[model samples]
Target: MNWKIGLADNWRRLHTKGTVVLSGGLALVTAFGPAIIDAWNSMPPDLKALLPQGIQRYAALGAFLLILVVRYLAVRRKGGGDGAA
Candidate 1:
């Protein structure tokens, strides 16, 4: 009974949560991006050599976050600046 509605609601909640989480992450990266990049670069030679995958993942995370925020803002602007959507 009403499982479809429940599923839609769950998906909506997940998407909204992702938007908020990614927005915050994007803001953080914008604020302290240099430090983050610096720390990543400062990893020891062996560690950097060993953890290329992890390093790439975090860099991707940062880029993904940046894209999310830009998309969100673009959508919001398109909807209108009346604080509607």
Candidate 2:
């Protein structure tokens, strides 16, 4: 198949799994948002200092993006729709 067809096929096969993962993540954040913020607020200064300045705010977003990038790379390396289902 052409690359475009293969890409579309891969996306169709992967879309449900991606949706579930993203939905679950959103649910967890919604359930824990308050407690998570409280924990972050209560973190000791020394421990908080271990992270780079200004990183605390973006850490979750960065981690989520990193997971996506890694998954995409792994899928590409596996030849996407060419791989066995």
Candidate 3:
């Protein structure tokens, strides 16, 4: 009944679910990659210009990484930082 054990179990459950979701998402992106690229290419130049040249892709990557870090921290904090599970 230790809290750390409870947190470990919770984290394991969340990790399994996250893995499944990530796998499905990656498959979907792969399936749509070509079409997505075509649509982006067909987008209007002005619309694309909303983001500064050469930085949009990096910005998106940074945002995704930030989200991942936030999720990690939240889970770690809930688990009391004992490196459980």
Q: Report, for every candidate in turn, its global Cα lDDT versus the true structure.
A: 0.68, 0.68, 0.65
Please give the distance, in angstroms, between residue 51's alpha carbon in candidate 1 and its true position after superposition: 2.0
Clashes of each: 0, 0, 0
Arranged by lDDT with the best first, the candidates are: 1, 2, 3
- Model 1, residue 17: distance off in Å is 4.2
| Candidate 2 structure lDDT | 0.68
Per-residue CA lDDT of model 3 for 9-29, tens digit only, reads: 566566445444654665676
Q: Which stretches of candidate 2 lie over 4 Å from their true place?
A: 1-16, 63-84
Q: Between prediction 2 and prediction 3, which has the larger TM-score? A: 2
Off by over 4 Å in 3: 1-16, 59-85
Question: Considering lDDT, which of the candidate structures 1 and 3 is the better prediction for this target?
Answer: 1
RMSD of 3: 9.5
Using TM-score as the measure, the top candidate is: 2
TM-score of candidate 1 to 2 decimals = 0.40
